[model samples]
Every structure is written in C-alpha cells, then in structure tokens.
Target: MNTPLPLNQIGQFDDEADVVILGYGIAGACAALEARGAGGDVLVVERASGGGGASALSSGIFYIGAGTEVQKAAGYDDTPDNMYRSMIASMGPDQAELIRPYCDGNVEHFRWLEAQGIPFERSYYPEKTVFLMTTHGLMWSGNEKVWPFRDAATPAPRGHQVAMEGDTSGAAAMFALLARCDEAGVRASFDSIAQSLIVDGEGRVCGVTVRQFGQERHYRARRGVIVATGGFGRNEQMLARYFPGLPDTAEPMGIPHTDGSGITMAVAAGGDVRGMDGLIATASIYPPPQLVKGIIVNRLGKRFVAEDAYHGRTASFIMEQPDQRAFLIVDSEIFAYPEIIGANHSLVDGYESIEAMESGLELPPGSLADTLAVYNQQAAQGRDPLFEKHTDWLKPLTDGPWAAFDISFNRSTYYYITLGGLRIGPDARVRRADGGVVAGLYAAGACTAHLSPDGKSYASGMSLGPGSFFGRVAGREAMRGSAAS
Candidate 1:
C-alpha cells in the first residue's frame, strides 16, 4: 500500500523543488511544463525510464473539439456549448461540471500543444474507425454520429490524431512533450517509485518518499505533489475490491504497471474515491465501422441496444445480457473478420439460414429468424423503429450466409482499463471524503477519476484530452500555494 509518511518520522529532506510530480507520463510532463513555465522549479519522478504511461501505448488521438484547427481544416463547424452537450449526453449530465471546462478550453489547449511543438495534421478521416492511420487527423472516435448522441448535438469528427503514422501517436506526442519539458529545465528522476506522500504536522502534503536505484530518498515539494501514476487495471486486487462482477474473460489493458499506487497514496491522504465500479471494458469490434449495419442480439435473439452505438457502449450493453451473452450478426457484406480481433477466436459459426444460425448457436428455434425478419423489414425502409440506429447505417441483412462473431461478454476476450481512482474537482485538487481539499495534493490522468466514468461513456481521446488540459490546470493551481510554512 502507498501510505503517506508523517512529518514526525522525517528528520530532513534530501532534495527539494517548488513542485514534485509523480509519473512522467503525458499528464506529469504537461504539469511540469506549466509549473516551470510559471517560474516554479519542477521535479518529475517517473516509474518508467522513458516515461510514457498508458498514453504512450495508445493511438494518440485526443477528443479535442470546439473547432480545433484540425476540425476547421476538415471543414466541420463545432462550438464549445455543442461539444459540452455532446459529452454530457454520453458521459452523463452529472459529469457536466467535470468536463465543461475542458470543452471551453479546447482552442486554448490546442494552441498550447502547438506552442509546445506538437503537430496535428489539418485533415480528416471521413470514416468511423477504431484507430486513425498516419495521414488521418480527425475521425468519429465516439458516438457523436450514433443514435442518441446524434440527436444531442450535430455530429462532428472530434478525434484529433497526432501527425504520425500507425498506432504510435502516444509515443510521438510524448517524445515531443518530453523534449519540451527538457527545454523548460524540468529535472527528471526516471525509473523511480514514489512510496508515499510526506505530510507535515498540519496534515499538508509537503514532499514525497521515492525509491530510486534501491535507495530511499526524500524530496520536498514546496508547492504541491501531483500524482499521475495511472489506474488500477493491473492491480487485480483493487479491481476485485472496487469493481467486482467483471467476468474472468476480461484482461487488463493500458499501462502494464498502472497499478494505482497513486490512488492508494491519495486515499491515505483522505481523498475520496468514486465510480469505482465503472471501467473502460472493450472488445475490439471494428476496423470496418460499417459493421454497425449488423445486429447485436442477446441470448433470446433480440436486439438490446442500438448497434450503431459506440463499440464500448455496445460492449457495456452486451455484458448486461442474459449469461453475459451476445453476438454480432453480420451478413456476408458487412462482415470483414473484425480487422483487429476476435475473428477466429470468437467466430461462432456461419449458417445459410437464420433458423440454422439459432440452432447452431443453441438459441431457441425461430428466435433469430423472427428478430431478423423485423429488423430486415424496418431496415428496408431505412429506419430502425426499435433501437433508432441512424439511417446511414441501417441496411437490411440480405447478403447470403450470415456470420455471428461471439461478442458475448463472457466468451469473448474483453480488455479493460481502470476508470476509478482518486476523486478530484475541475481544479484537479484531490477531494477528501467530506468534499474538502487534500491540501498540497493535486492529480490528473488515470490516477484521478473525472471524465469517462464508465465504459459506456468512454471516447477515444477522453483520457489524453482531460489528462493534458486539466494537468496544466493542476500545475498552475499547485504553484499558487506558497511554500509550506
């Protein structure tokens, strides 16, 4: 457990800085950049040598909106209010307070990233995709064009991918940011592990105890300590304790060492944790987004959610089905082997008739046939009366020999990222159980829970967007405090 060290036990500090940041991922780097840019001495301690958490492993697409230069170049109109509405609709209206500021500060953050030498191509990937390629700049990374979200706000491609090829955008962005951090003169202590916060007699966090190269060293953070050590996806005990009922089929994804030590430290500092049961559970179901034209049915062979919903949303719904069972039924035309995963692993079987498909999958006879009859009927007229999938993706399944991919929550290999951590306000200050601040403690990124409360609400760039933007906010706020008296 990462516990706070009482000042009474600390005789002296071995080192000190105006701000000490744990975790040199994107959030920590951005925090250091801001704090240093504000004329504060910043020291960053990272668990990894190169210092890119789950972010470095991602595709580097950010959910930036309100008409970023990329969006404008792509010729799409966006507004802060619309972006706010769209996010609140998917992320829950209660999250408005947490995410509204990020939406409002979109353009400002984009400019800041640009100022830091990060480049975003002024282009657009017109298709709905799971990941953008090198030339792709903007795409629909969420349910912006899907059923409920479409009616919530005019659809726009908000995923601003870094100007690079392949799935290494996170690496590219991190390299650029780390370079910027160096230019700002931020001191780095890489391959270091923070064991605890150093709290003074007044119960204020004054420093941290970090172990580097087998030596325990105490470093003072005169202003504040920012925790960005990521989530508990890799901490099975935390996952079982905080959010049980996750099927055994789910595997931990994201940073391998993202074990929630920072959250544990924050809890010891009186930080209240919320949304512990929510997480980003995903089963890669797209490369050909047209798969939405298919139907997802429960064990009873009836569609439960709009197939056009975001893959995460659909996955969430599927997990709620009977026996955590569901399948993606696609006619030959729309089925493309699910480009990324679960092709042979989840392919149940193919059948020439709906009745055979049901029997082969062990569902009640005529169930799938009956369900498809209605779906095909409504789809012919280009409408979904039940789920309200967009007309663009509404097409009757007529192409021969249908195939069903086993997207059942229990049968399919589900990958999840932890979404629960220390609860913080828009200011990025760690909040106590009583809704009071944990003095001298600030956090952003996966170590703190704010945006994307659950799998259903997750958008591709939600993590990077809030992590970097609010990270700067956390940095600026941490420096506002006078050195611990």
Candidate 2:
C-alpha cells in the first residue's frame, strides 16, 4: 500500500462510533443501514442541512435486472450472465470481477431496496425519452436496444424507476432510504463537513476530522470510515486539473456539495483513484418526446448515430464529432409544443424542403439532400441500414417545415457530472496504486469509480444502482473488520 498520512496530532476526539459514514445520500444511508444491522454503531455525517444530495437531484432510476420479478412481470427475460456481459460491454472492463457479484445478485438487490421501503410498480414506460414523467417501473435507460450491445447481451428494460411521478422520484427514494436508516438507529449529524481521514499509528483509518458549525471536531471510528461525499463536478480547479479538455463553460449537474472532499481525504489516507477523466455528459432533446423521431447529423450533414439511442450515448457521439457539434433535424409534422423544462428543443432553422434546409444549414451542395434521401428511403421501408435504429423511432423527413435544433454539449441544455473517484475493490475498500487495500477506508456512490465510468457507456440508473449496492457491501465489510478486531 502507499504510505498513509500521519495521524492528526492536534485534534482531540469529540465523539466516537463504530462506523462513521460521510454524506447522507443513498450510498451513505445504505452503508449506515447495513453497518447498524451488523450491530455496529453508525454515525452518518452530511454537509447539507438534511439528507438528500445529488442523488435526490436524479430521476431515481435503478438499473437492475437478472430475472427481477418486475422484469418477469413485464415479460422480459434476463440473467446474471447476460447482465454481466452487457455491463462489461457498456461500462467498460475497468473492474469486471468486482462487478460480477452485483450483476449476479441484482434481483436480490432489488428486493433489498424494496425492503428499505423503496417501491416499484410492475409497469414499463413505453416512451423513448430521457426520464420518465409517469410512475412506470421499468424502461430501457441505456443503448441496450441499439446495435452492438443488443447482440452482446439479451436486451431488457433494466431501468427500474421508483413508483413516483416526475423528477421527484429521486427525492422519494432518498426519503425511503433515510427512513430506513433512522429506523436502524443510525445517528446523523447535518451540516458537518468531513475534512480528513484520521489514520492510526498502524496506518489504518480510524476516524475523521470534521468541521461543523465553525468548530473543528474529531469523530473516532472504531470499525471503519466510509467516504460517500460524491464527485468533484463543482470543483472547477479539480476539473481543470483532471479534465483540461472539458470546456470551462459546460454546466455541471452535480449538487453544490459534490466537491471531492471525500476523494481528497481518501487520497491522503493512501487510497488510489481511477477514471478521473470520465464524465456523464448528456445532450437530451426530449420531454416533447416526439422530437426523438428526428435525425441527428454532424457538421457535414451526415447522420452519425441512431437518434433513438440513450441521450448520453447521443451526447458521446456528438462530443466525438469534429468541433463537438451536431444538430437534430425534425419536421413540423412531428414537432409538438416544447416541454419548457430540461433540455432546449427550439428549432434553429426551418425550411419547406430538403434542398432549402440544406441551403439554410450551409452544407456542401447536395450533401444534406443526399443524406436525407437515403434516410427517407430506408425509413419508408421501416429500416435503418446505417445505424439500425428501432423501427418505432424511424420516420421519413418528407413532410414540409423541416427544422434543425443544435444539440451540442456547449449549449445550456447539456449537463455533465464528474464520473471518476477513489478506486476501491469489490469489497468497497479503498485501494492503493499497487492494488492493495487501505485497511479501514471504504468508499461508495459517486465518490468511487465503479459503474458508468464514462459518458460513452453511461445509462440512466447506473449512478444510484452502484451507489446503493456497493454502499451495503462497504458497510458490511466495515462492520466485519471491527468485529474481527
């Protein structure tokens, strides 16, 4: 293991607990629940006035499968092997071994969430949209239906949304988790900022130094300390240091407290970090879900990606384009009133025909026309030869009133979050550069690099999926460590 930071010499203990969890988001709440259930006294610290963090800002979708009862009820078949294969193909092979058990036990994990009072309906959201506005329980939140991944794994609607409508489901999920934590007798301190990890003489993390209400306080952890303080999307300096290529003007979709404090603390305690350059960039253009039927083209007016794929995948392809720009081409027939919320869907240019639209976009003579001609021909036959988009989303752009909406990442609608953090093993113990574990340090949630390492592979429910799952793993391990000692 890398050398650990020396113990805090000046600080004296103000309180003590068997397990101390940083941040009261889904991960920290799950960790506290598991640790308390394991008979370890748990103390959860949150920088916010109450519980919810970036997790509550999410859509509350959990990407779980492996023969879940809801999946079976929805007439979808899934298995651990298939889910594992899909995860590897989508999220990359960063920690495949560590992810194996989670994929295998996904159904059990779903039950675990339900036991925590997180409810899920059996219905599936049929629309191909960014997030569900209805209380549907299942949907295809990733590019599982698109090319390559479809052949890699058996496709299923793995995005299980809470039985709550609109964006408030995330808050609902968190409220359930917080309720479970409270019932388990997990104590929490609000508005407490964890400054650093306190290592013992033997280099085991024993506690944390926190700043609460202008006073420096030390909380001793007899078992372990879990860092779930979330990612560093809000920290512009860290963003510059790690993701220099990312534009400074890009909007971050992180909560204000997602400032990488837990990561810095773990690093000081000899923990390793990974996938620091990874981000969950999104370029959604829906809510008026009809816009999904449009075609996305690059600067050369060539259709690059299947417009029906997950918005994150669309964003990844858009960012990969030259100058990181792309446009969504749609016609007035398919256009509806804009959603007025989330991503912008206003048209930049409108035209009566393909030729006029091409000229308006200023593309080379006949380029846009030729592209649209081929797309319309294939779409008329209910086919997508180039990108193999689903037939339900394929439609000819022959109708008049064609328009183009700029869907580039630089726009106000685009939002992203840092996806890199401390590298931990399957046990959720923080690891060193040499792949050795930091004895008493654990991490979960957006604070650790696990699921959805990058935008290219990101799915809707990946954040909370791994956050809550691994939080339980970390909590159990921490309690086990304390019991052995």
Candidate 3:
C-alpha cells in the first residue's frame, strides 16, 4: 500500500486545506460544514456559477423512510432492521448492509437539519401512519404543495418542499446552505472544475487539479479530499456506457452539472463502479398536456400503472417495461378537469412552460394527434417497437387528441437522480475490487452506489434520509483519521 503524500512534497501546495470539498451542492456543503465544525479548515469548489446540482433541481421532497416519533407510536414495531429490509426489498439487497446504519440514523440527521434553521413540518395528515416514522416537509421559498402520502403504511404528506411552489427546492436548498456556509466563513468559488485527483507518490489523494476561467490551479488538502460532485446522469457517453437500456436523448429536467465528475474521479483512482444500468425511471407527461390531463402509455397508447401513482411504483413499473417510454393519454374529462394538472392537487405545474423553450420534445409546441397516430400504429402490431414496450398495458388509442412523446433515453419529463454510482462499504469509504479502502478519500449523498444497488429507491423519501445520515457519518470519520503519510 502506498502512503499519501503531503501537498508540499508533490508538485506544489497551493493552499493548505484540512478538508477540500469538491462540488458545492448540499452534500458537498454539508460535508464541509461538518468537517469545519469538527475543527477542520475547509474549502468548497463548484464547476457551476452557483451551487445546486441535483439537490437544487429536485422536487425538494426529503425522503425519510420512517419518522422517528411516529414509528415509535405505531404498533408496527419499526427498527433499523425493518427499514433495511424494506429498502432491500424495494431497491435491492446488494447495498443493504452499507445503508442500514445510515437509515438507522436518519431522524437524527433531520433534527440536525432543523437545528440548522432549515424549517420542516410534520406529516400534513398527522393522524395517519406512514412507512417511516413521521413525514416532514421543508418550508422554503416557492414551495407550495402539501405533503402527498397518507398516514398509512408509508404515510401521506411526509414529503417536504422549499415553500417555493413548484420545482424550486434545488435552488432553495443551495441558497440556504450557501448562506450558512458564508456565515461559517467557509471559502468557496463557483465555475471551478476539478480536473483530477492530486495523488502523491504514495498513491493517497493529497488534493486536486482544478481549472477555472481558463486557468489551472492546484488545491491541497492537509487531511482529506471529499468528492461530493454529483452523478453522471447527464453524460450521454457515460450513460450509454453504463446504463444499457436508458436513452440519452431526453433533456435532464434537473441540474445540468451532474456529469458524473465524482464517479470519474473515483474510477480513475481504481475505484469500482456498479448499479449503472439500472434506473429509477419515472413515468411523466412529456411536455405534459397543457389543457388536458393524461395517463402514461407506451408507443401503443395504453395505460401501464395507475396514472396517479406515486414516485416509487411509477418508476418501478416504467423500468419493468422494455421500451422505457410512456405516453400521455388524455380524455374529455381530463380537458375539463384542468385541476388534474396537480398530482393529488398538491404539486404545482412545474413543467407547464418548458414546451416553448424546449420544442420538438416538450408538449404544447408538439402535435398531440400526430404523436399519437405514430404510436397507435405501432401498438396495432403484436410488438410495440418505438420504445420496445412489452408490458400488457397496451390498448387502442380511442381517445381523441391523445398525445405521446417519445420519452425514451432522454425525452421523459420527470427524471429523478438514480442512486447508483461508486460502490462503498458501510464506513462510507470507496472500496477497490479487492475489498479494501481506497485511502485518503470519502463520499456521501446520492453520488455513490451505497443506497440502491438494485437501481431503485427502497421506499419513497429514503434518499434524503440516507444522504444526511451517511453524509454526517462520513464527514465525522474522514475528520477522525490522519492522512496516510
């Protein structure tokens, strides 16, 4: 094993940082904050002009499996074991052991978030039961929807929004954290890209080679480098190479910066990757019907799952299909009930205006009848070829003005960040194929394959829970160890 070299011993030590965090999004900012709180000097770098990777672009629903107090009150006998089993059953057991500890600590992390002045609310339906303990929604600018789940098994109204109605959680979370960081005196620069890991002769990461505004610069870490850089969902080359069936043509409705920078950095350093081919593909209306409500159909113009299904089941059903595309089938009732625009009358129309700027792919700008005609033709045959949909949901397009978008690859409107990336152990450290830690580094948040090795969410809202739990743990652990000398 090689020892990690100090930045001074290598090419040059730009600045001595106790913890150098790449990517200024939630995970990156959280890691920096924790490290700084633990007495480590920190530096944050972002490739974008502002922070908001996927976190900024999200629906802002914090995924928590079970609320702490609620689970205790319910007679369901919830435990970390229960949460782990649920997650494994929902996603896959491949990464279960790694994620269990984090799930166990989820509520504590949320409390941490609350302590940081990030306001959250209990389940809107307080009397009901949910999958996790309690449902909490974030109260930030622009979020207007009430929580969606019921107080049953998974509980309703646990999802939180940044008070900003529609899809503003991404920016809200970023700005909130940015303000906190600025108050904490952590240094950060936007539009700075991390080119590669700065490893020394001993093979441990000492820092990074970064480029900003046509200038190359090196930043050194005295303790460690944390790669909170987002995933590769937008990189067609990487997606095609990893995700076998996913189409790359659909534009990402979320952040534009998630080009798998962290995955690349880790893989280049001999880290192993997994769970890329699987996706938590969502069923959404492409350029969603403006004046009409709709159901997701394949090229055949048929409904697959319930048109009003929640996130997990919706994505799971879509992934089960062969073609991976869904259509928005509408009826006269849909047109009349424009109020159907909201999912459960809570979510505002976030995709309402994208059609004008993103024509050919979005709705309103595209033809509903023409799109449906082509799909209806394909459904008539024994096979649905356009998107290769093999599900039994196929039916004739009897509805008038029915529209369809070829949401294959990249055409779908509501694409969530799949939790699949560099596989890590329970300690939140990246592992080589040989099952040993790749020293001088750590990771957190949705970037790693730690959550959904099976390529799906264990349950709805589990993503944020794990992000906070593991992010806090990894941050603390990384600060505890000395850099390999």
Candidate 4:
C-alpha cells in the first residue's frame, strides 16, 4: 500500500498524459479506449508484464440487456424497466441508484462491446446451469427465475458470453480490449506498478507515482488518474481489516495482482470505501444441472437454502454455517448432463441407502432421516415446501446409492473475490467521506464498489459488467473534466 504525497512535495513529472490509468486489465483498457475516444491522450500502466488481470482468468460473461440485438434475435423480449427491476431485485435496493444508468444504457453498452470487436452469438441457453457450455450468448446468470425475485421482475437471460468455443472467452475478451487500446494509440507500459496518487494544492489528483524497471518515477495527468487495479482478494491485511468474517482458510480465486493496491491508494487519498464486507464466494456446482436436484445440508444435516439458488448465494450461506461447511446430497439416479457441466466435481461419499449414507457422514440420529423424509415427500409431489425450489428441480432422492459432495469453503471447493472498494458516483468519480467527489480521481472495476453490494445476492458477470461499463464512464468523465478545465 503506497502512501499518496502532496503535489508540492513531488518533483517534476518524468512523463505526462491527459489520462493516466493504472492496471491494464479489462477495466483499465476500456478506460484508456474511452478516454482516447473522447480525444484525450491516454497512458496505461500495468503491474504485470502484459495486459489482462483477473479479467483474463474470468469466464468472460457480461450481464447486459434491455433486449440486446442478440437477445432479440433469440426471440426474447426485454425492456429497460424490466432490466432495472431485475437488477434492483437481484443486486438489492441499495444498488438501485448506482445500477439505474447501467440498466437504462445496457443496450447501448452491448452495442459498444460489439463495436469493440467482442463477438456474441445470436443464441440462448435454456437450462439451469452455472455457465454456458455451448456457444450461446444468453442465459440466466442470476436467480432470475427463482421465487421472490422472479415475481418481482420479469425474468430474462442477461448473461451474455463472448461467442467463442471453450472457456477461453476471458483471454479472448482481454485481447480484444487491448487491441482497441492499441488502435486508439493509447501508450501502454507493462511491468509498471502505480504506487500512489499525487494531489495538487487544491486537493485535485494531478498525477501518479509508479515503479518501473526498478525505478520510481512520477507521471503527470493533465486530466485525471483512473485506478482500475481490481480487488483485494489476495491481500490478507486488507481482508482481515475489512472482511473480518471471512474464514482464514477461504482461498481467493483471482490473480495475485488483486492485492487491493488501488483501494489502498484511494483510501490514502481520503476516498471513502463501501461494501468492504461484501465477498463473492461461489460453489459452482454444475457440469450437470441435474445435481441441482440434490439437497444441501449444513453440519447438522439441516437444509439451509434452496438447492437451486444461485451458486454465490449458496456459497454465502455455507460460509455462514458453524464451520463454514455444507454438503450436497445426491443419489445414484443423479446423472451428469454432459453439456451442462462446466467442470468435473467428485462425489465425497456414496452409500447404498439414506440411513447408511447418514451414518457414513456421522450426522446425528434422525436428523438426516427426518430432513430427508420431509424433503422427499414434498419433492415426490413436485413441490418444495421449505425452500420453494422450482418444480423442474424438485425430485425425490429416495433411490439407492446416495452420495455427498463437500461444498465447504474450508474444503477448497469454493472460490472467492472481495467485492468491496472505494465508493464512487455514477460518473465513476471516487467520493470522499464528506459526500464530495475526490477531484480528478476516478476508479472502476473490482476496485470500486459499484456492483455486487451484497455477497449473498451476488450474480455472475456482475463484476465484469460494472467493471467494464463504469470504466468507460470513468474515462469519459475524466476527459470531460479536462475539457471543462
């Protein structure tokens, strides 16, 4: 965590640009492109040897709509109002104001992504799966079809993936973004780490101090400095300070560069942080959507959540358990759907009967049996009285050869990323504790708390969706500030 210094204390700049961006991930690259597109000279400094941060390691899914062209071609009717309602319901009302612009401009955002060479197929995946195994461009990334939220907003498939085979869409998406930056003549410096921001006498951010080639140098930003350095998933110190409830054994799922440097730098400059406790823990239990037909039990063998809920919500519930543990109970009839399984998951134990399986798991007497009896009774009638799981996934688990899959956070079966960072306005300008903007300072991506306000309701693609979209907003606004100046 580098400490920011006052402008008067820093020496003359070694380089200068209209907009200086830190971390050349998808967010930073998008910011650079938009800043350049806004007629501002752009400079991108990446800590890695090349572009692509965790964005390259992601599944490359973007949650966007308002009846995107691809969604329309796929015979899905969507509207901004419906998308807005869904986002409010899915991400929580706390995020409604920040997400309103995103929902309203989603169609244009989709078009912008396509214009940047990001491709999407005119197809839809109609399945209750974790990720799109096919080249389908559209699917439900969140629990849109589930109860409560389903009735609150018209459900639509908003998970738009890049049209490419295999899981390389993340890398492919980063490559396309970098290409756009190149075409825009954005100067990129790899292996350059931004340490801290430089602020002018008026308290406006004016430049950045970076370490490159074993030397610390200062670069002036005529307009502003954008911090897109991702989250603090790998920063143990930040996690302990902000997210004390996170289990010690919980492993971060992103690249090592997500060490919360951007958030730290912003904070050092008096930026207020939000949603610091929000963490995106996930148990991606699909390669076989049929596995969702199973039941999830806590240590007491009690059902905690709807088995078919979004994986993030399930993981969050599991983490809140006594020992941060949970198990997915299945039966011999559980057959893997080849097309739906995104990754292979091994079963922990298998037994010839429910009693035998319960004994093998060492659960209390009748705890497993009674829970199963009620669940099986409701499931047999295509109903879930407890969790209200959809009928499509309501099936009895009475068959022999029962199995359990460990979905515990301590068991290395779950991956996580911190979803909290500096608070920012809709224009992506970093805000201070006094409810005022930090002049000339902006942030986006995982480093800013714009989307995913709560981990319990986290949706897939929410990170990259706001990361990229707000990155564009930050860049454009930075350029506008420069023009106004």
lDDT, each prediction: 0.85, 0.84, 0.56, 0.83
Candidate 4 stretches with Cα past 4 Å from truth are: 245-249, 335-346, 483-485
Query: Per-residue error at 355 for model 4, in Å?
Result: 2.4
Q: Per-residue lDDT tens digits of candidate 4, residues 406-437?
A: 77767744568888888999999999999899
What global local distance difference test value does model 4 have? Answer: 0.83
Candidate 3 lDDT over 1-485, as tens digits, reads 12223445556656667788888767787887788789887888789887667677665556553345433433233455545544555455677676666667766766677666665544242221112222234211100111122111232233443344454454556667777878887888678888788776666777877778998778877777777876677877877776665554333435777788777887787677777765554433312223212445444434555433334455566655656644444433333322223222222222222232124333344344455456556656634454334323344454443233333333444354555777767766777878887777777776776465432343434455566556666667778869555
Residue pairs with colliding backbones in model 4 are 287-341
Error of 2 at 308 (Å): 1.2
The C-alpha RMSD of each candidate to the native structure, in angstroms, is: 1.4, 2.3, 9.5, 2.1
Q: Per-residue error at 422 for model 4, in Å?
A: 1.1
Question: Of the candidates shown, which would achieve the greatest TM-score relative to the real structure?
Answer: 1
Looking at model 1, which ten-residue stretch has the lowest summed lDDT?
336-345
Question: Model 2: per-residue lDDT, tens digit, 169-281?
Answer: 88889989988888889998888988887787778998887889998788888889999998898887898898776754477886888888889889988899999988877
TM-score of model 4 relative to the true fold? 0.95
Q: Which scores higher on lDDT, 2 or 4?
A: 2
TM-score of each: 0.97, 0.95, 0.71, 0.95
Candidate number that wins on TM-score, 1 or 4 = 1
Worst 10 residues of 2 by lDDT: 1-10
Q: By TM-score, highest first, what's the ranking?
A: 1, 4, 2, 3
Error of 2 at 455 (Å): 1.6
